[model samples]
Target chain A: MKHIIVYIEPKDASSLKRTSYEALTAARSIAGDAQITAFAVHGSEQALATAGNYGVQSVVVAKHDLLSTYSSTATAEALAQYAQSVSADTIILSGNASGKEISPRLSVKLKAGILPDCITLENDGGTVKAIRPVYAGKAHIAVQSISDHSIIALRPNVFTAKQEGSANASISSFTPNLEAKHAGVKVTSLVKNEGRLDVAEADIIVSGGRGMKGPEHFPIIEQLASTLNAAVGASRAVVDAGWRPHGEQVGQTGKTVSPSLYVACGISGAVQHLAGMSSSKFILAINKDKDAPIFKVADYGIVGDVFEVLPVLDAKLKAMLHS
Target chain B: MNILVCISQVPDTTAKIQVSGDGKSIEKTGIKFILNPYDEFAIEEGLRLRERFGGTVIALTVGSETSKEILRTALAMGVDKAGIVKTDDILDSYNVAENIAGYAKSISPDLVIFGRQSIDFDSSGMAPMVAEMLDLPSISVVSSWNIENNVITAERDIEGGKEVLTCSIPCVISAQKGLNDPRYPKLPDIMKAKSKPIEEIASCHGSALVSLTSMVLPSSKRVGMIVGDSEAEIASVVTALHEQAKVI
Candidate 1:
């Protein structure tokens, strides 16, 4: 029996929308006979209760004054304390902003190994192996954690949460003697990106590149996205040119998203760009060049003009949805 | 003020990439190592901050002694001193950040800086992890920063836009591109860099915490069918997109 824990980020729950359940799934899968403890920092009880529906046996709250703010060290220290208390063999964290920040710090404190941005995880006879992207998304690396303590940052959108029953998971409190001087960084304000779907949470995304010509040409992608109720994205080239916001950029430098379906428009698949979006469940590429590398990874590819094609597809989609 | 900038050695982006026979590691043939593009931004910002307020800027790198080349480059760019945490080990970013934070604390700098992410292993988690270890306030991917009365103001990239933040001094910041174009090293500065002090502290602990078990390259692509050409080809492509791909 192995015990697993999830370091939850409450603020990102709504933004990420589904990582709690996914984290639970990964935790349960890894923990055979052992219990699963879901830890949420300075968040409400409702958030912890929500964990029960996802099969978490208990919830641990690191209730403290400073927990309300984002303290990488404090959060890491707190999680490390909880892991020690529960004797967790593995710690599961959602591959979101907060988890990404905390997992490594916790790994350092515990002297544990960390598998980052893993698309999948499995345990074989007390050995936890995680699959991650390597070679800039051109390859997959399967890594095994040999340390007594292990951390896995599950790639978002790979696992859909399945609910069993709702119950009050046994809740406990945890507090780390956080040095006041050490709780330094704080998330003063989160300038939430509005009007577009979060790539991390989106089921489908449509991304464009420099081939769109300019920022003005983005209306076509927006229209297509609007018709399909999909998220919008951009290539590094477009973001580099300021044609799109940096958040919209999908590449190694930008956000790494794993959507159910990804439509790449007018973008040649550069390796750096593909590393971020290669985990998409279904990839469709549209470009004018027949030899673009994206077409190799794309399950479906179209070499033509995005400008004329998007509107027609939008209209047909609207007609089909209306019909 | 004491500022430390952590630099990584990476192959030039424009260079061709060749993988090993098994596709596990990058083939270093013909590739030249340079200071990470983002860390260069960190070095420039450190120099800028030092010039604005008389301070010491020390550049550090975690690699073999040859990695000191980038430190030398930073020193030539007017950084006061440089150091190399010589290790041929590829520690996970966590271990790397831990080693860096420990070394930084040993020096007791007023501020620490690095790029948002390194090119080789772009976890983008190094700065935050270091901040976490030291419990230092941090703002990442900052385009602008200001220092006044022991407080630091900065900005970071958010989902849709950017967030502006202010924290106390002795903070950490990960540099974002366009923060400042790194300045060219002058001959006088290059000559002076030869005389700068440097230290190599070999920490025999940590590293090799995580081992890459297996790896595979991306599957080869199929020769996709080209429907037509130009704007008119878009209609056929869209039709194919709906009927064949069903993406619509």
Candidate 2:
């Protein structure tokens, strides 16, 4: 039987990101009757308890003072040691920024194959086949692991998180022996974007493009986003024009987001922009031009001035939600 | 102060991608290939660093002969030298990283830079893996960078905001978009780049950890109906969203 391990990251000491649960769901689907271990560095009891709800047989928590803060190299070393201890054949992680950073280190350390940003996976007998987008979503490639051990980073929101009856999983602690060289890189400070959800994690995103004209016009998009409890995203053009920060840009060059609902306002859908968000479950395009490329992929199109449409929609949504 | 920039050639973002008949790979016909856009930032950063630090900047790529075009673009951007790890095999990220790390060991550059991820594979693994192999510090998705007295300070985008990090020299950094504006190559520079020699080396045929089983296009979305552009349609759109689609 194949041994699978899902890497979990706690958002804080008390809670975990939703994507970790999604990774758990993916692990369970591929584990079949094999053993599943939820692994984390500096993971708390609360996070392990949550992992237990996903039907994992056991949880491995690696504790180190250096791990209290995020150190990609140190964490990878710890996780690799833990994986070796358990002889995990397959490792799964969320394809978020942290996972993207750490997976490579682990892959090199273990000399294992890695598939990043996978959308789907299936176990064909003993070998696991996975599908992932390539060429920035222009096409998909299905790959199978040829090595004895492999790593898979699942794209968030693609796998549905299903809760199984609690397994009351036993927790094991692992302390890795890391040297001073492993702590070469340090996070000096983090400037948090207060009161705003990151576009990558938000369920709904209201985005603007060059059609918003200038930085001054972004507040309307923000208003709509706040009304809908959504995050605000910008197209590459606006970001290049210095109207928005790069972190907020959504495109092939920026963050790939797959929210439940995506509203593109004042955006003439460039192929690069669509490549990032076309996988959204529901897309709504609001632009004055009827022939905007966004409308081609949008589930619903509203050809109107965003200035006029946005306020009306915002008011309507506010009322609907309040009532 | 030597710097090495790693780049990848990818289909132009606007290129039409078609699946091959065998369902194994993308059809290459009629597609315009260009340097991965994010790599442009890496090249630009390398040039800027060389200008400030007085050292050679080398551009390297691992791919087939077609990837030489990518090296020329880097040379045109003022990279002092270019190299290609020539291979046509579809290698996985681990193999690619091992090859890059192997080359890096021979060069022993002070700084190694890469695009945050290649647009083709979207695997943001190579730079860190190389750093690990070389036992150097590395940071990814850096938007701003400064070096003072051999110490590198970088600001990178995290989930909500940015994180400021500090590391010593002989490090790896992956460039993100908006780090800096890449320059357009002048005609003279483009001509010079065409004449510059690109050193080609045979790639290490490491065993691929992952093998392609098949490839397929994403299932297309259903054809959506267009509602009229009237204020009256707002209510109907909301009703359709709430009742028909139920996404909100």
lDDT of all predictions, in order shown?
Answer: 0.76, 0.86
Q: Please write out the lDDT profile of model 2 over residues A183-271, one tens digit for every residue.
A: 77888889989888889889999999988888999999999899888999999999888898777889888888998889999999998
**For model 2, how does the per-residue alpha-carbon lDDT over B1-248 read when each residue is reduced to its tens digit?**
89999999988888888888878888889999999989999999999888898999999999999999999989888999999999998777777887888888899999999999888878788888889989998999998989999999999887777889888989999998878999999989999999999998779857888888788777777447567666678766776777777876
* Pairs in steric clash, model 2: none
lDDT of 1 at B102: 83
lDDT of 2 at A317: 75
User: How many times do residue backbones clash in model 2?
Assistant: 0
Count of steric clashes across candidates, in order: 0, 0
RMSD of 2: 1.9
Off by over 4 Å in 1: A11-16, A165-170, B14-24, B132-137, B159-166, B184-199, B220-248
